[model samples]
Target: MKMAGIETLSWEPLFVMRLDVAYDRAHPVGGENRRGIFPVVGGTFEGPKMRGRVLDGGADWVSWRGDGTMLIDVRTALETDDGALISMQYTGLSTPTSPEAAARFARREPSPYEDLYLHTTPRFETAHAKYEWLNRVIAVSNGMRTDDGPMYHVFAIT
Candidate 1:
């Protein structure tokens, strides 16, 4: 068997999104796991090439896995300052660095980003000609939980 050699990946800064979200108690889905739906009430994103406000109707459906990792599924809408609308979605994982960190997160304590391994791959869609480039790029993000909700530093793979 042979494997092809690939070039190293590079990233280009896209935006920083900070969300304001609301969470309700999760319900058990099965053995040692639970599910929760969180509403993304509001947020804003800014970067060198674009700026936008996150629409209020978006949501994040989270799965609390038995192994203590949080599986994230998020869908959201964004309105550029110029009125163009974009749809964004991502699936990611948030795993605690240790059992104690997981416990702190479960208690809604202030667990720093250093205490968790959080990463996401985001996809973008839009019909607006001005930003059509987004439709073809691959993107990833590094994320952290905040008191207000979560913050992400999004980048496009090059």
Candidate 2:
């Protein structure tokens, strides 16, 4: 018997987004996790297709699990250079490469991107005709934590 082959997926560079985040203390929610809220105060993004500033008033609701993994749900908006507003949301998983790294992160210390696994799936919505294409693309991002916030290299699935 012969097996069918699978096609490899490809990606195209979309943008690089650096979010200036404000952290809030995490408090125990209950049985197995702690919850925290992080505000997206401001930032900037640039790419081949677009460039803009990240609007204020967005936030990330984070859950720190007992198993040392962080689950993040973020909702933010972007204002293009030309003034088009786009809403963006993403869900992501963040895991430290080691127990020490996890401790450092908990203490709000910065870590190299290689010291953690941080990945996100982002969905974009826009009413601007110039950016309508974003509404239909499947996007993914790899991110790293910084002292000021987090920066992500976003890509579009092809």
Candidate 3:
């Protein structure tokens, strides 16, 4: 079963790969935790074929093409299965400045519909964008300002 838009990027008989990939780079970011991990996932979806990639579990980057609409955003986030926090931020398109604005693009429901964005307590010490509650799973699609900009939703899962 798929949770959030983050379905099993790679489905294996007994082990389905979720968006919880980590990198070798690990450090501290301005007194915050730096796990060098990005919880991003990609899969075929309904219309635009949404593809997501995390920058650090905090930012999500997505790309998809529809009838006459092309999407690209890199401002998305996700939590880890082990309760680690990661965040993503884009250098190009201006990301949401406020939590309200950021949330405007945030997923309202889970991916594939029924699956809800799971939440858990972060084990690492880090400062995320704004949202108080982190999501275990997330989906990217068309929306107001969110779906309008380039797919720069960067993500960083555990």
Best by TM-score: 2
Model 2 residue 14 CA deviation (Å) reads 0.7
lDDT agreement with native, every candidate: 0.87, 0.89, 0.28
Q: In model 1, which runs have C-alpha deviations exceeding 4 angstroms?
A: 1-5, 24-33
Tens-digit lDDT track for model 3 on 1-158? 66777854431111111332222232222222211222333311111212223233332332322221212233334343434344432322223344554454344212321121212112212354433333333322222221222221222232
TM-score of 3: 0.19
lDDT of 2 at 76: 98
| Consecutive 10-residue window with the lowest summed lDDT within model 2 | 24-33
Native-vs-model 1 lDDT?
0.87
Candidate 2 structure quality by residue, lDDT tens digits, 45-89: 999999999998998888877788899899999999999999999
- If ranked by TM-score, best first, what sequence of candidates would result? 2, 1, 3
Pick the winner on TM-score between candidates 1 and 2.
2
What is the alpha-carbon lDDT of model 3 when measured against the actual structure?
A: 0.28
TM-score of 2: 0.90
User: Tens digit of lDDT per residue, candidate 1, span 1-158?
Assistant: 44589567799999999987866633345444577778887799999999989999888888887688899899999999999999999999999998888887877676678878989999999999999999998999988777776899999998
Candidate 3 lowest-lDDT run of ten? 43-52
Stretches of candidate 3 above 4 Å error? Answer: 1-69, 89-158
